[model samples]
Target: MFRRTFWFTAGAAAGVWATTKVNRKLKQLTPESLAATAANKAIDAGHRLKDFAVDVRDGMAQREAELGDALGLNDQDAPELPPQRRIAAIENRTYPKYTYNRNEDH
Candidate 1:
């Protein structure tokens, strides 16, 4: 009789454990749970990507400053790069406009 009772108790415990596990798995598999998980992961990825972009921009600016120092760009009397390389007159050159006479078409 004691053996039967022990078996019965063990079976009930096993059944309860299995039911709890199944319910938890079902909750995780539901649409709302899946969508929330995906959204959280996406937000985490976006934050990481934004951080990477910020780091890259900072590195570029630092490298640019280092190069400028090497090239004497910070000196007051140093010739500038792009400003001195411009040709303003060629950019401003224009052609005379020709008017069409109606009497010439005839």
Candidate 2:
């Protein structure tokens, strides 16, 4: 009875090992399946990038229109301003000192 039980356990282990080897061989036989999966992923990524570009362009146009309205100018008449010039204007007009206390102590 003990010998029979040992043989049965060994057969089950061998069956599992053989099944894994067959599965690996089957995957190796189908190269086109792997290539198709990679191509599909690339196409998906390209579509997502195109969508993002359209969204960014739309947002920038909307923001420019709003800024033109606030400045009391038509969108076509709005003057183009560089970011650096705007920053410099704000920095020059705004005081940097935090307090009027000129004394070093007290």
Off by over 4 Å in 1: 1-7, 76-106
> Candidate 1: TM-score?
0.61
lDDT per residue, candidate 1, 1-106, as tens digits? Answer: 9999999999999999999999999999999999999999999999999999999999999999999889888665756566556556667678899999999997
Pairs of residues clashing in candidate 2: none
Candidate 2 ranges with C-alpha deviation above 4 Å: 1-30, 75-106
Model 1, position 73, has a per-residue lDDT of 82
**Consecutive 10-residue window with the lowest summed lDDT within model 1:** 78-87
The top-ranked prediction according to TM-score is 1
User: Each model's RMSD to truth, in Å?
Assistant: 7.0, 12.7
- How well does each candidate superpose onto the true structure, as a TM-score? 0.61, 0.45
lDDT of 2: 0.85
